[model samples]
Target: MIQSFRNEKYDHKVEILTPISGQDHTYALLATYEGLAEMELQNKKMFEDEEYKELITEFFLQNIVQGSMTTQLFRTMTGLKKETNSQK
Candidate 1:
């Protein structure tokens, strides 16, 4: 599934993370975009792709637990200044 998403050639970053302490059986798939607009554009393209559709129907639907999936979006806080070591 991770490879499939990478093959789509979208202009974003993707990563899969496994828990170190909590949630032993759970994994997180993270996709980062420049902003909301780029996220929307890439999502539209992803859903429209035939390969992605096939993956969802043939693989994701069968293996993943029903009602166990969730989607969340987060954005970095704006106007935050990076504190240099010297400033501390």
Candidate 2:
């Protein structure tokens, strides 16, 4: 599925989300690539981190939990406290 949202503040900018698909979920290759691109933009550092990449790969191999993946990526990138667990 393609998820898109608009922000009035960004005016011309539109946010499109394409999360990865798990074994149970069927997703288009283009959509998954788009999601990866979005994640890269959101968290460049996390993508660059080898350890983080491995963890993410493992998580995806197990299941593509879009919400969890996105949330973790965002939190890791923003250095914000996680919803369930706080990180220093």
The number of the candidate with the highest TM-score is 1
Q: Model 2: clashing residue pairs?
A: none
lDDT of 2 at 19: 50
- In model 1, the Cα lDDT at residue 11 comes to 81
Model 2, position 47, has a per-residue lDDT of: 64
In candidate 1 the C-alpha lDDT for residue 38 amounts to 91
Runs of candidate 1 with Cα error greater than 4 angstroms are 1-4, 82-88
Show the lowest summed lDDT stretch of 10 residues, model 1. Answer: 1-10
* TM-score of predicted structure 2: 0.28
Model 1, range 1-88, lDDT digits (tens) per residue?
6554754578888887899998887888888899999999988987898977787678676768888889999998989899999998
- How does each model score on TM-score? 0.77, 0.28
Count backbone clashes in candidate 1.
Answer: 0
* Model 2 agreement with the true structure over 1-88: per-residue lDDT tens digits: 1122122311223344355655544342211223556645645654666765776578577767556433222222446555755533
